[model samples]
Target: CDYELIKLRSVSLEALGENEPGASISRCNTLRCYPAKVPELIQNCCDYLEKNALQTVGLFRVGVSKKRLKELKDQVNLNRSLTFDVSTNAHDIAGLIKEFLRELPEPLLTRDLCSPFLNIPSS
Candidate 1:
């Protein structure tokens, strides 16, 4: 085995919500427009499903920068709620839900539960 010193370089992950112009919006936007907290973001998603039922076919995707995710994670860890100017950062509620899911460190469902969850009856 050859012992050679090699240098490692750090590269940033791709920015969220940038590839597509209208596909996703900023987390700040959604927080301001819907006036939601980290926890409330999930509730809003539930409400949307309840209100729209199966009729909700179209929905915009949500995206947030890694920096924003870190900020949100910090706030959530510290039990702080997000706050921003509504007029300036108004965003889609659906998008915020998507962002929340995306930023989670682990999948919503555990590996063991995944099988049963997927097996749930559609009816």
Candidate 2:
């Protein structure tokens, strides 16, 4: 399992290095940029979403471009090794988080939670 994880990591890292127009690398070294861990991205997103439930509806108002999605993923993975701060732009970060969630290859919320999630009493 460890070897597979390492292999996947290296493959992903290698993939990130490739550049394209408007890709994450293009934005790197610009706008208050730094690496961010996946969990940090998730937490930042959760915090923002929890506080501003209405934003979720607006999130889909603007169609997320591929460039933006790539940039968001890059930022999250890049910051994995660095110290986190709340200095990053919240609007952009929130959009990125929403896009990340939408683009996930698999559902983050597992089957176990589906029924409970739906059964939650609506306030």
Candidate 3:
């Protein structure tokens, strides 16, 4: 039998918190200025990484379990609150953040801004 394919759904950051009055201050195809300003998944992952994984070498280069990563992605796509406990692997969260960006319907850096970002000089 053939393996069943799973079609992952990309979360629309702009559409988040739209149902709540005054929740969104502004909306764009790429990003949203909602009450929180950033998507919950991105904020949580960054917070976790800053608090726990800042010193971990190769934070983003390291790989995590595919199954676990998929589970995490599913949780975020389902809009479930994520709790990263001490037992959670930082690599998984880092990978999740990368996956989230990669899966966006539009690139975080839109085509118009790509050149400007690419032109930024290195230190």
Kindly give the stretch of ten consecutive residues in candidate 3 with the minimal lDDT sum.
1-10
Q: Which stretches in model 1 have alpha-carbon errors above 4 Å?
A: 1-59, 62-79, 88-96
Task: Write candidate 2's Cα lDDT for 1-63 as tens digits.
Answer: 121112223222222334334335523222222243233335556666576555455554555
Error of 1 at 117 (Å): 1.6
- Say which candidate scores most in TM-score: 3
Candidate 1 residue lDDT tens string, 1-123: 110100000111111212234322443333322323333445544565565543544554334454554554454335434443332122244454565564554455858789999999999
lDDT of each: 0.40, 0.45, 0.64
For model 2, the run of ten residues with the poorest summed lDDT? 1-10
Kindly report the root-mean-square deviation of model 3 from the true structure over all alpha carbons. Answer: 6.5
Q: 31-114 in candidate 3: lDDT tens per residue?
A: 333476576557778989999989999899998898988777666546444677767899999998787676666786889899
lDDT of 1 at 14: 17
Model 1: how far is 72 from its true place, Å? 7.1
Clash numbers, per candidate = 0, 4, 0
Order of the predicted models by TM-score, top scorer first: 3, 2, 1
- lDDT for model 3: 0.64
